[model samples]
Target: MSTPVYEKVALLGLGLIAGSIAWACRRDDVAGEIRGYARSAESRDKTRKLGFCDVVCDSAVEAVQDADLVVLAVPVGAMGPLAREIAPHLKPGCTVTDVGSVKRTVIEEVAPHIPEGVHFVPAHPMAGTEHSGPDAGFASLYDNRWCLIVPTPGTPEADVARLEAFWHRLGANTERMEADHHDLVCAVVSHIPHLIAYTMVGVADDLSKVSEKEVIKFSAAGFRDFTRIAASDPTMWRDVFLTNKEATIEMLGRFTEELFALQRAIRTGDGEQLHAYFTRTRAIRRGIL
Candidate 1:
């Protein structure tokens, strides 16, 4: 058999993304040994009981002791602290990656602490469900998804290609982009949509009293989908919005402008204008599919 892509891989967090990575890497034999660390004892116990890692470390530093690849799968807000904690323990020449949703702030927060000789390849796997925690993960989450690799200027070409191949083996289609650009695009496509879903669902909940339980009883699949997205781990989404502030704010600004226009169209009974706008959005969805 060919050698495994990574002899030893360490995962910083053991939530959905990290658990999915462990499952995928093991299933595909991408890494020989998987070491995992979680801050909470409960999480660490779950990681061990789930058999997600070859060895479970008590601390992030111990997790990266000899890992050739270290993936930080924590919330975006925790990236800096985790990076600082693991920097001293990362083996030289190791490739440290992340499965964060946002890129710009992560690069700034996590990159500085990476020691010399260690390579940092910031990546965002454009995949995941509304689920959180290890039990909610599956090996196929990354399958057929786009994994964006945002590389710094000085990263070695070979290392970049190797990491790209790693994600490919995990069943992801890989693309490279600038960190800032990745944040901007994700904020528009994923972040703002999630925010809107949460708001709409919350509004429905608030109106449930007037609806006399009809809203909950008669909710359709469309609203159900919104509830799923809105129900995603609050802490993770909170960190995402906080860490990727500029992009989220910019997208929110644009979203508010369109929302006002939509409200105006409704008040004025501008059916033609509304129809054209909806048609345009439908085309975009069709393109995505």
Candidate 2:
């Protein structure tokens, strides 16, 4: 067998991202031994049964000890406390990273807890279905996806490059970005869109005349897509909005202005304005395609 990138890797949370990482590492020979920990006993038990990690430890500190790479896959809000809990046990020179969507808040919360010799590289893997949890992950989840590495100003270039290579081995295209810029880009591409999906779904639910059965049965592709996005893990999204408040709120403000303009066009029955706006938006979709 070929040599592994890291001899040992510790996964601090065994949810979809971590579980998928373990699976991909095993499939690609990325790490020699993988250790995992989950806050919930049930999650630990499930991971053990699934056999993703070489060892399933009882605590975060135990899992991370002596590991070359440690990934904090917990929710955004929980990162700081988890960092503090595991800092004392992290091996010197071991690289620590996270899979949090919001980077600036994560850096503020996690950076201070990292010990002197260890490295902290915050990353966001732009992949995942609405489903979460250990069972929701698969080895191919990250294939063709983009993993953005948001390194701080003082971060070592070698460490950033190593982490970028690691993500590449996991089948993702890697790119480096600044933390604040990453948060703003994600707010426009992901966070605000999810909020809008949730709102539209909620509006559908609030319409008394539209029975729940009818809503489900008569759903078009657009509404169906909205429901799929609205089904994302609530705790994760709540922390995302709270932690990335400035960017998310800014995107929401812009979204509201555009929505009001569209509403006015509809109220006034301005067919030309509606057609032009829609044509321009449709061209944007074509650009994506």
CA lDDT of every candidate: 0.90, 0.92
- Please list the Cα RMSD from the true structure of every candidate, rounded to 1 decimal place: 1.4, 0.9
Index of the highest-lDDT prediction: 2
The sequence of per-residue lDDT tens digits that candidate 2 reaches over residues 1-289 is 6568889999988998999998888888989999999999999999999999999999999999899999999999999999999999999998999999999999999999999989999999999889888787789888999999988767788988888888888889998898889999999999999998899899989999999899889999979976788999999999999999999989999999998999999999999999999999999989984
Give stretches of model 1 more than 4 Å off: 208-212
Tell me each candidate's TM-score. Answer: 0.96, 0.98
RMSD of 1: 1.4
How far off is model 2, as Cα RMSD? 0.9
Tens digits of lDDT, candidate 1, 75-150: 9999999999889888999999998999988899999999999999999999989888877778998999999999
User: Which clashing pairs does model 2 show?
Assistant: none
lDDT of 2 at 128: 89
